[model samples]
Target: MSFRALLWALGLLVAALFAASLLIGPAGLSPSDSLAALIAGRGEAAALVMREIRLPRAILGALVGASLGLSGAALQGYLRNPLAEPGLIGVSSSAALGAVIALQTGLAGAFALALPLMALAGALIAVLILLGLAGPRGGALTLILAGIALSALAGALTSLVLNLSPNPYAAAEIVFWMMGSLTDRSFTHVWLALPLTLIGWALILPLVRGLDALTLGEDAAAALGVRLARLRVTLVVGVAACVGAGVAVAGAIGFVGLIVPHLLRPLVGARPGRLLPASALGGAALLLAADIAVRLIVPERDLKLGVLTAIVGAPLFLHLIYKTRAAQ
Candidate 1:
């Protein structure tokens, strides 16, 4: 399909899935009632369920998914690495570590916003540390190494907190939060994550020309006036903002970034510039579909979004690795 057609198709799919996410739920209301409740706030009970429960969840599913997808595409394009993903920069793990700390110290319990706030703080700190470690002259290899080290350290600290937790309830909370879900979310999360996500999008969307040039190699791109250093800084900070805000509100919804960009790349003719927006739409649709499936697959079980994504993504990731090896 042409690029325009691909975008149109993806946009329609996202719209459909978003509607499904808003309408399908345990409430089992008719589609008409759901729409009415959502639009007009009719039917007090249905309105409450629609407005207070499903609406925010649907909005977040789309927002978080788009962020992850956009971030992944940007990272892959900038790093020129198929395996690159949003989490590669350690922001997600660092954010998770921050949330875990808040829970462990009862800060999350005492203050409703503490968990997400701390998580955002952790992500910001990780970016600063990553920049420091990568340094001004650092290349992709150096950035990768720095990110890996930061991710490892943050993950280890999170494990340590879980291991030493005295309160079972707190530990349980931490564990579930890490697993990731859209359950019981509110507009507070919607508002909290929106501005940063938009800013990240702004930061990333303009790098299309740079990303396209980089496909020809770093030296060639620089010779073409791509300003490699500026591109790197923008990409890193943008991914941090997107991933940080996402993990802050939704925990760690793994694989949306990895899977969406990878799936849509071939369709975009392997062009990084085209892949970015397509991946964003694809990611939003995939996550919304996944969220809806969670509601339908086991209404009582309350399945975690992260677990489902991992189950689907891990095998595919391994297959990608195998394919890469064979090609090499």
Candidate 2:
């Protein structure tokens, strides 16, 4: 299929899934009632649920998924490594660490924006550390190794924080948040994450040509006037912003980045440039579907969004590793 056609299809799919996300929930309101509530904004409980709860959740699902998907495609393209993803690089974990610190210090309670601000800070630090370890002119292997180290260290610190927590309730809340969910989210989260996510997209969308050139190898791309170091810095910062902002509000929703790009790569003919937009749409659709399923499957238990994504993504990840090993 043509790229335009693929985009159209994915767009339609996202729209449908988005509508499903908004309409499906435990409230059991009729579709007409839900739409009416959303549009008319009556002073009723149904209207409150429709406007305040489901709308924000749906918006967040799309934005967060798009960020992860776009970030994954960009990383895989520049790094030329199919295994590259935001969470795997410690971006999400580091962001979560920042939010955790805010919560632990009671700054989040005191300040409305503390959580997201700290999360963004954490993501920036992770990227800085990654650049320091990898250095200029580092190969894909070097970058991946540095990312692995960062992930491990950040994860260890997060665990230590959990272990030493003074408040059991706060610790439990942290654990639940880390599991990742869209439950009880509001417009506040939507607003908090929107600006940074859009800025990240702006930073990344212009790099398609660079990414396309990169497939020809770094030297060839440099020969084509692609500023290799600048590209790396921009991509890393964009990933940090996108992933950090999303994780700040939604907690750590893993594997959307890892899964979406891989699934759509074949359709995009492995062109990193085309893959970026396609992955974004696919990611949004997949996440919206997952969020809807969270409501449908064991609705009483309130299944976490990350849990379902992991259930699907973990096996695919292992298979990719096996395939990579065989290719090596």
Candidate 3:
């Protein structure tokens, strides 16, 4: 199918999934009932369920998914590596650690915005360290290795904090949050992350052209009038904001950013410029679907969204590794 056709199809699918999300919750409202409740504006239980729970969750899912997708695409384009991802490179892990600290220290309890703010700070720190380690003119191998090292360091720090927390309950809570789930999310979360996510999108959306230029090689991009250093700074900031806010709200959900971009790249003709928007839409759809699936798959248990995504993503990673080895 053509890129336009795939985009249209994916858009329709997202709409359909959104409707399902509204109507197919544990309380079980039919489409007709949901529509009636929405239209009547009465004190109906179905309306309350639709409005208070499912609607906010679905919207938040879309926002989080879009943020991850866009950031992933930008990172891959900027680094010129298909394997590049925000979480894999330590951005999301560091952000999660910051959020965990905020939560454990009671700062987040005092102020709702503390979590996202702290997470953003952590993300920026990780990005700066990664860039400093990679240095200018660093090759793909150096960057990847530096990212891996950063990720390990962040993971160790996160583990240490969780272990040393005085309250076992808080430590347990940190484990659950680190696993990444959208269950019990409310409008408060939506309000906290939405503004920052939107701002990040605005900053990154204009960089698609620069990404496209970089694909021809950074030196070639410079020749084509792309200011390499400035663009890199913008990309890093954009990814930090989006990924940080997302991790703050959703915890450490992995692989959506990595998987969504690559899955849509083929349909979008493998062009970074075209892939960006498509990946955003596709990511929203993918995560919404995954969230819904998590609820439905084990309704009693309430499976985490990240676990489901990891189950799907790990095999794909293995396949990629195999392909890389074969090519070598």
- The residue-by-residue lDDT of candidate 3 on 1-328, one tens digit each, is 9878888998898798877777667876667888777677555787777777778888888888888888888877776666667777788889988888887788999998998988888888988877777664445567668778877777777777877888776666555555677777888899989877887888888997888888788789999999988987887788888888988989878788889888988888888987888888877888898898988899888788888878887787667657756776
- Each prediction's Cα lDDT score? 0.82, 0.85, 0.80
Give the top-scoring candidate (lDDT).
Answer: 2
Clashes of each: 0, 0, 0
lDDT of 3: 0.80
Cα lDDT of model 1 by residue, 1-328, tens digit = 9999999999999999999898888779999999999899999999999999999999999999998899888877876767666565676789888878877888988995677667767877886776677663445556667777887888788878977899665555554545578988999889877877888899999999999988888788899999988888888778777777788788877778789998998899999998999998988898898898889998898888977888888788777768866876
TM-score of each: 0.88, 0.93, 0.92
Consecutive 10-residue window with the lowest summed lDDT within model 3: 134-143
lDDT of 2 by residue, 1-328 (tens): 9899999999999999999998998899899999999999864999999999999999999999899899888878876777777777777888888878877888988996787788888888987776676564445567777778877777677767766788766555555545578888999999988988998888887899999998887789999999988998898888888888888898888788889999999998889999989988988898899999999998888788989988988898888878977886
Candidate 3 RMSD to the real structure: 2.1
TM-score of structure candidate 1: 0.88
Candidate 1 vs 3: which has more TM-score: 3
The RMSD of every model to the true structure, in order and in angstroms, is 3.1, 2.0, 2.1
Q: Which stretches of candidate 3 lie over 4 Å from their true place?
A: 135-141, 163-168
The TM-score ranking, best first, is 2, 3, 1
